[model samples]
Target chain A: MGPLIPNGIITGDWNFVIAILVGIAFGFILEASGFSSSRNIAGVFYGYNFVVLRVFFTAVIVAMVGLLYFDYFGWINLSQIFILPTFWPAMLLGGVIMGFGFLMGGFCPGTSFTAISIGKIDGLVFTVGLYLGIFIFSESFPLFKGFYNSGNLGHVTLTDVTGINAAWFAFAFVIIALAAFWVTMLIEKKVRKKITEYKF
Target chain B: MNTQTKNNYKPNYINPYLGGVLLGLLVLLTVYITGRGLGASGAVKSTVVTTADAISPTLAKANAYMGKFISGDRSPMYNWLVFESLGIFFGGLLSGIIFRRIRKPWVEHSPKITSKTRLIFALLGGIFFGAGSQFGRGCTSGAALSGSATFALGGVIVMLTIFGTGYAVAWFFRKLWI
Candidate 1:
């Protein structure tokens, strides 16, 4: 019943307008949360600050639970929503590469944009690199076209994989996220105590 | 009350939990309204297609991948993600202004490294990110957050591998951050 745009309840013309509004909320939340700071973001790995882990896990759990509730309440049709298809090899490779990128650049695409908004030169350079890298991929598509398109697992959800209810997965995830938050906090305290130069 | 000044300025960052809740709700709203989640890398993908087309319509048209996005019917830039990405910039700008964080260009890096060194890695990092997003079919925003939220197995897989890999190799890049 919901998912207005997909269902035609909302006109196609409104897509762009909605995009801006949603994006604004996204950007505002990210910047206000201190994601614009590379040091803060990298802190997840260094154990100085665990804001990334805390915020990330919290958000995932909240959204996961919200979606399950929405489905149960008939507010939205879960089947109509888009799911990320499983492209096994490509995804694994991409995630590994992106992990390295996150470490070295100290920012992801979303965070970089926010940093650029505040006049960070490194952010600007990262943007330039994004273009160059993508352009290179596009130009060199022929070399890895087969490999890129090899994996073809269809769109699947955790319920399908585990043969359990979505609610169960949601429940389990909440527990896991909470535990992670707790442990990261301990690590953060210890790391910060040792590094006097680091200031949050 | 004490007057506000640059020297006495305070650093303000909201509680992580609060921020997460807001972000989570926003993600829920997006899926509810659009039947899709938010994305950042996809917007740049569009730019790449448009740029390739601009340089050589024939070449871009001939390339199997680039050609998939280039259409004679509509401009490549007229995309939902492109508009959304623009909003991200403006929204970030708004936040910066409110926080008094808007300032002249500067490089953020560890005290151990030079600005030039940081920039070089930033560029290289972006390049890897760009390639990875394409291969992964989404960036952190699209794949990791929105994907995981949606309960997609692939999203969860990507999220795990990404963070897992980061932790596995973070020790090697200690100087870059720590």
Candidate 2:
């Protein structure tokens, strides 16, 4: 009933059209949330702003819970959904590198695209960096090929690995999100009092 | 020069919670429709593969990484993520136009740093991020968000590692933002 493409509810030719529409929605929402500004994005760490945390956590929980409901209702088959494979070592290394990139660049790939659209020079530079990085990786594929393919645990879920049900995980996330939101608010008040400029 | 207007200006961002809900729904819909999550970096990877393939078919085929993506009958540019990224670009443009946020070119950074410095770092960051995404199997959107929503263990690891690293490095790069 769901996953319209694989089940033939929607044909392959419409894929691009759907992609464009979905992407537009994604971009609009992201930009509208002030994600176009690196300063705004970086505020999460500085305690000046927590929009990134608020939005990201809420989105994840909502989606997580929603998936559970959808599965319960039999609207979407959970088995058909794609799960990103767990390549532990590669992901850890990649995540660490990406973290540095985020700190220095202040924009992730999607956010950078939105920033670029809004005429951000930094965003454009970041995109060029992305191209160059990929180009380098492609050229030197053999060098890190073994490392990339190592530590493959397949597509395993937290519930599968931890023996906990999905619902409990979702509930725990909601609680953690609520706690973070409150703590961030307190931190923001303290931080804002000390700073004379850079109004959030 | 409309000083009053400038001084009184307040940004028009939607509520974080509401935006989150919408984003969540969109992610849910994406999974429901395609049985996969949204992504940004994969599109760039496809372009790299397609471009290299176009330049040297033999070399592209010979390379272990590029070879996996190359299909003898078709082009890599025809992949789903590439089209989706194209959509994202247009979508962002549309939103920028609608909100009147599109403007002259400028670098966004802390007042402490010059535009040139910011741009250089941005490029370097993008390079690392792009390369990292290839190894990580997805970017923030594809791996972290989508993977986490599905309770995928790797998703949690990527998410924690990224934010953890961000917290660790945030102090050193404070001048760039704070």
Candidate 3:
């Protein structure tokens, strides 16, 4: 009944068209939310702005709950949905490296695209660096191929690993998001009072 | 700290909560339609493959990683993520036009640092993020956000580790942002 393309309700021919439309929406939402600005994004860590936290946590919880509801209504078959496979060591190392990237670059891959759209030279440079880095990785694949493919725990979900109902996990996430929103608001206010150079 | 600047100019972005809701719904709709989540880095990967393939088919095909993506039937750039990324650029451009943020290319950074310094850091950061995404199997959108929404264990693990590490190392790089 759902996941239209996967179930044959919609053919593959329309896949590319749909991809464009979805990506447009994704990009528009990101830019409109002030994510196009590196300063705005970095504010989450510095406490001057919590927009990243607010938007990210809200989106996560909303999608989490929405997926559960869709499953409940039998609108979408949960089994048909893609789940990212786990490779613990590799993922951990990747996350650590990306954290440094976020701190130094102040933009993730998606956000950098938006920044570039608005004529940010830094975004443009960052993208070139992305290309160079990927090229390096591809060339060096032989060196780490063994480790890259290691620690495969195929497509397991939190519910499967923790033995908790998905609904409970969703509820917990909502609570955490709400609390973070409140706390960050306070933190932003406090931090804003002390910072003079940046105005948002 | 300057009341004059604060009064004269106000940021015109949408509400964070509203933006979040829209983005989340979009994620749901994407999965409902395509059986996959949103991605950005995949497109870059595709482009890299295509470029390598063009430069030296032999070397590109010889590489363990790039070789897997090369197919005789179509260009690697013909993939879904590539089209989606094109849309992302256009969509971002549309938003920039609407918001009147489009401008001559310039570096954005803290007043304390020179633009040259910022660009250098940006490049280094991009390199790190690009390499990390390959190992992580996805970036924030593909792995962290979209993965967690589906309650995927890998998604949650990557999300936690990413933000956790950011928090841990953020202090050292405070000068870069603040």
* Best prediction by lDDT: 3
| lDDT tens readout by residue for model 1, B22-92 | 99999999999999998899988999999889989999999978899988899899998998888888888
**Ranking of candidates on lDDT, top first:** 3, 1, 2
Ranked by lDDT, the better of candidates 2 and 3 is: 3
Candidate 2 lDDT, B10-110, residue by residue in tens: 66788999989999999999988888888999888888888888898899889888899998788888877888787777777887888787879877677
Give the poorly placed runs of model 1, Cα more than 4 Å off. B1-10
Models 1 onward score TM values of: 0.97, 0.96, 0.97
Error of 2 at A105 (Å): 0.4
Provide the clashing-pair count of each candidate structure: 0, 1, 0
Cα lDDT tens digits for candidate 3, A1-200: 78889999999999999989988998899999998888999898889999999888999999999998899999999999999999988999988888888898898889899999999999888888788878999999999999998998888898888899999999999999999999999998999999987878
lDDT (tens digit, per residue) of candidate 2 on A1-200? 78788888999788888887788888888888889888888888788889999899999999999999999998988888888899999999989998988888888898988998889988889988988888888888789889998999999999888999999999999999999989998998999888755755
- Candidate 3's displacement at residue B80, Å, is 1.1
Worst 10 residues of 2 chain B by lDDT: B1-10
Using DockQ as the measure, name the better of candidate 1 and candidate 2. 1
Docking class of 2: medium
Q: What is the C-alpha lDDT of each candidate?
A: 0.88, 0.87, 0.90
lDDT of 1: 0.88
